[model samples]
Target: MYEQKTKETDQSVMEFIEDIENIKKREDAYKLVDIFTETTGYPAKMWGPSIIGFGAYHYKYASGHEGDAPLVGFSPRKAKISLYFATGETERDKLLQDLGKHTSGKGCVYINKVADINVEVLKQLIDQSVTFLKETYPSE
Candidate 1:
């Protein structure tokens, strides 16, 4: 059976943020930590090797692929900050329209910096993602 490598771990999220070499990205990581935690009402946790995630959920596909994932998370990559959210939600697209300067993929949003985006919209995105995930996949 295939396994998921990005399971949540006991690793220190603060240590991960401190290891970020870029000062600005480091600062943004901390800011995101606060923003995500405050918005989602969940403490941050380390996911995989790089993502700082808030809350969590278990998901199983119809094809039998199943794994645990964060409700919302962000990684301060070398090139950009990656924001994770519930994909395929219609409101996600609508929220992105007011999210200010950012790019996105199927399930991630890429931002150059926190300053380039609207923090309020980001909060809305976080809240909506959590609500959508909980409704879509109720936790036991």
Candidate 2:
């Protein structure tokens, strides 16, 4: 009966962006919204308190853990902007090489600013994440 803490919320995405203290991060958040929306053909939705997500899919692992998560998303945190994408795709590493200044974790890509990364590569990551998630976990 474990519940997910980061489930989608009804919060307003703009209101969340507007609350960002950093003017540059706020602006970058807006730009990311536009890019993710255009690439995924899905409206931005507030995931949890901070994540702005596009589209969603439900996933159940072999261990029986299951949850619904955004196909593509990002968060403008105090340290850096974190981009969320599928973790297992090999092509992700290939694209990240072409993506300008960024560090990556197991499933999150961190960039100081939008200008620090190539926007086209960001779009490709978004599309690839959405495609991978949809194909991996098609809804019944």
Off by over 4 Å in 1: none
What shift in Å separates residue 80 of candidate 2 from its native position after superposition? 0.2
How far residue 87's Cα lies from its native spot in candidate 2, in Å, is: 0.3
Across 70-111, the per-residue lDDT of candidate 2 in tens digits comes to: 999999999999999999887999999999999999999999
For model 1, state the Cα shift of residue 135 in Å.
Answer: 0.5
lDDT of each: 0.94, 0.94
Q: Indicate which candidate wins on lDDT.
A: 2
What is candidate 1's lDDT per residue for 1-140, written digit by digit as tens? Answer: 89899989999999999999999999999999999999988999999999889999999899999999999999999999999999967889998999999999998999999999999999999999999999988988
Q: Cα miss at 85, model 1 (Å)?
A: 0.5
Count clashes in each candidate, considering only residues at least 3 apart in sequence or on different chains: 0, 0
